[model samples]
Target: MGKLDLVMFEEEFTQLQEIIGRLQVDSSSKVVFLVDKNGQQIAASGDLRSIDATSLASLTAGNVAATDGLAKLIGEKEFSLLFHEGEKDNLHISIVGKRGILVVLFDHNSSLALVRLRVKKASRELQEIFEMVEKRAQSQSGESSKFESPFSEITDEDIDKLFGD
Candidate 1:
């Protein structure tokens, strides 16, 4: 999973957290989490005590990446949504704005149709927030050269040595 370039401000972060929290309740889910493509947990709400969030985020990102590969192989763009049903639980994962992955965990109490409906609305709102975050990041990066290059310290000598020149 590659890192996402969008820089989220505190305001946007808080807003997104709230949205995730609301989605958990509205969807009657056990947990609702927002993760970046890089497997970084942006915001999560609900019962997280039993779950290892770090693992969940990383694995979820990997799952999305694999699903995307499958999609391309079938002459499709990408599988924007995924669902996994377990014996006791189910997961609904959706890609938001091509930046964040929203995961909702539910059980028999919630129907897939209802979760999909709620997710559709929440995804739109999340997409808007992500767009704002991207614009802000672009403006900030534009003002400074720091964000432009991660290896700015590398010199001609370094490259020559790397190539055994």
Candidate 2:
């Protein structure tokens, strides 16, 4: 919210993308992604070939926001992660930055401790990347105002025209 002076380095973003991809391979996980706070997919890897990372990213953020809110109400600080293990599907979600979230999907063979350990290291790297992204966004905001709103500019008519009945 404050003036973002630190820019997200492209090199770091690329490094993070690679890091997640490597983790997927090393841990035998099926999916991994880096998402912005608004739910936009920043980077991804693994068996998410068909899944939509953008939507997942947003849902992950919602999960973090809910937990963070709860923590505040309980007089606790924001924790790094939340894990959900079901009969079949398992999910590990973590906050990477103020405006970033990481979601990992795996099977029963993967241990929560391993995921937590990997995430701790990943989170440290992501925090650095996000600081840079914030700075870049702040610097670019001045020039970005000239463009029309990407979402607002598209209307129902445009959608219907693109895929008409």
Candidate 3:
């Protein structure tokens, strides 16, 4: 399998944050977070202190992967969206491009229909930003071919020195 590398430049990050911000307001969601397919969080907005963002991102990706596998076994291409409704809060999870996932958490303040509508718009914007970042990373990779790996110069002595008393 090819390695997965996502490069988020400052401009791209800013745009992504704006998208999440808009979604949060439009959908009335308590939290909105973007996660890559590999479980790395790109951006988030809303009440982040109430929950563990990293754990949520990781679990969301795993949930998508499990649903995708289930779809394949049943002869479907893939399930692009998954919804989980709770007593007080609900989750709207959707795929962004093939390599990213968008997650929204909302309470009774927002209706599912509205969340879906706003998420649809945000997903399109995020996908475009992600594509731009991917292309830039690809182009930059070629230009950095002359740089040597920093780890190559590190020896066992260097490791031991850092830990020594």
TM-score for each candidate, following the candidate numbering:
0.84, 0.73, 0.87
Better of 2 and 3 by lDDT: 3
Candidate 1: minimum summed lDDT over ten consecutive residues — where? 1-10
lDDT of each: 0.90, 0.76, 0.90
For residue 77, model 1's alpha carbon misses the true position, in angstroms, by 0.9
Over the stretch 60-160, how does candidate 2's per-residue lDDT look in tens digits? 87778888899999998886778899887688888776877888888876777777777777788778767766766765777876645456578788989
Per-residue lDDT of candidate 1, residues 1-165 (tens digit): 444366666899999998989899999999999999878899999999999999999999999999999999999999999999999999999999967999999998898998999999999999999989988776776587545655668989999998999
What is the C-alpha local distance difference test score of candidate 1? 0.90
Question: For candidate 3, which ten residues in a row score worst on lDDT?
Answer: 143-152
Candidate 3: where are CA atoms >4 Å away?
A: 145-165
Q: What number of clashing residue pairs does each candidate have, in the order they appear? A: 0, 7, 0
Compute the lDDT for candidate 3. Answer: 0.90
